[model samples]
Target: MLDRDIAAFYGVETKRLNEKVKRNARRFPNDFMFQLTEQEWSLISSQFVMTSRMKRPKKSLPYAFTELGALMLSSVLRSPVADETSIKITRAFVAMRQMLTFSTLPEKVVTLAQELYKLKEEVNEILADQNDINESTRAQLDAISTALAELQASRSQDATLKNRRPIGFIQPKEDEE
Candidate 1:
């Protein structure tokens, strides 16, 4: 199935759907999904005519995730459609895997495992980068909070000085008839 079709079933715009996957980040390991490099994109696009007529807003192409990636997505996003879609998609994947296992040459399993391992490494790197970014943001926020506290203290002192009133303003005065 095309990525676009699966994205639509989740009730999210394509970009938002991708972004959600990106945010969860860890749930998707490499076997589940990987970015399509230019060469890979060219190969995929040449082989498949599905996206040929569709007008894309950007020049850059999007990555395609395998069935495993789609299953990983359901773990992160909690929507009614996600549940149903996950079940259906997982079944399809299981059938495909079973077919591959039964029909494929025995020698291919080693190569497939090696590729899967590399993909998992890439997914781990993506999650690590996200964690680094979160850490940096937390540090920046802490610095900003410190600066704000200092500013607030200075402002409070100035306010006390400005707010002081002379005796005339506070003393009891007779109201003229």
Candidate 2:
């Protein structure tokens, strides 16, 4: 279960929930519960948060309890509701693990999805670059075509001028009388 959703289920503020775990720190040994690193937190945040949100505000993400930690938490928690919820959570975790074991495709699907996302980004970047290059090439070709058309239109006038020139006006031989 996601930390946020778990927090909501326990009917406590996420900070207060973390504080309870912090106060009873020894129950959560390193393996039982661990704080998410900055990178791990960011990845989780990106996964959970909506893309439309402009910025993801950073927060002190707390230690997440594993199965052992959650069971230990059930013992320490003061409320009956929390204890009951913990049992349910534990069962859910077990069920999820079982489901994962049953499915061979889950791991492969995740890997393939990550690779596909990377490839899509690369392809989009390449297409944007290609579009820019193509536009420039088209503009250059249009300019060249316009210049050729103008040169062709002027060729007849130049030919007429050459034909109109008198032969006497042509340069005389050096020995002419």
Candidate with best TM-score: 2
Model 2 scores what on Cα lDDT? Answer: 0.74
Q: How close is candidate 1 to the true structure, as a TM-score?
A: 0.50
* Model 1 lDDT at residue 163: 64
Number of backbone collisions per candidate: 0, 0
The residue-by-residue lDDT of candidate 1 on 4-96, one tens digit each, is 656877777777777787898787777777766677767767787575526544465665778878877787768888999899888987999
Q: Which one wins on lDDT?
A: 1
Error of 2 at 29 (Å): 0.2
lDDT of candidate 2 over 1-177, digit per residue (tens): 434556666777666667778799877787787887778766766785464123323555545667777777666666887888888988988998998886977788999999999999999999999999999999999999999999988997788976664567566455466
